[model samples]
Target: MNARTNIQFINNELGQPQFVVMPYTQYLELSKSKQIDTEAGVPSEVVNMVFDNNYSPAQAWRKYLNLSQVDVANRIGISKSAYSQYYKIQKLRKSMRIKIAEALQIKPELLDF
Candidate 1:
């Protein structure tokens, strides 16, 4: 095979490769061929917001998508102040995370750090 060797293998206790790691772009390409939508990925825009502005994934996506707290809160059927409190939370529960993602109109995995 004439494939690039830009991948890594993590071995388990039995000395056999149990996990693989590679560049995000490469993984996306492979996933496309396999028809999988893992969505376990972050966008560059959201990543930059997290690093440059110290914002949470939810906050970052909200800003990137040009949606206001009130807008998302309305979508989630909550008050703006209540929605704002979610950003202050260190980690939201799965159901809340999904609600936030839905409000932001993005894949839930994008909100995962």
Candidate 2:
């Protein structure tokens, strides 16, 4: 299906493009497609756990994926202790955050505070 996207670009004072405005339906369609591309075959229970509000984004995804801190640490080339500290600080360098999100098969923004 060819979906029609009605979009408008909002420019900054300097005339550079700064924002995009689209209909809610279009936004949902785009989000669904992106999620499908990234999350194919991931269990819905895992997705729900990741989206649960009680846990920090990292903790939720990590637990849902049944990954130990050491596992993520190894993937991101950091120490297990350092990875544990990420939850305490609730902050990660943008690049590291993106790496974690990639490891979890979700968008980076989902892990952002």
TM-score of each: 0.63, 0.50
lDDT of residue 77 for candidate 1: 98
Question: How would you encode candidate 2's per-residue C-alpha lDDT over 47-95 as one tens digit per residue?
Answer: 5655565565677778877888888888877888877777533556788
What are the per-residue Cα lDDT tens digits for candidate 1 across 39-99? Answer: 5556578889888888888988888889888899999999998898897554678999999
- Superposed by TM-score, candidate 2 places the C-alpha of residue 38 at a distance from the truth, in angstroms, of 7.1
Least accurate stretch of 10 residues (summed lDDT) in model 2? 35-44
lDDT, each prediction: 0.83, 0.71
The Cα RMSD in angstroms, rounded to one decimal, for candidate 2 relative to the true structure is 6.9
Q: Cα lDDT for residue 66, model 1?
A: 91
Considering summed lDDT, which 10 consecutive residues are worst modelled in model 1? Answer: 34-43
Each model's Cα RMSD: 4.5, 6.9
Best by TM-score: 1
> For candidate 1, what is the lDDT?
0.83
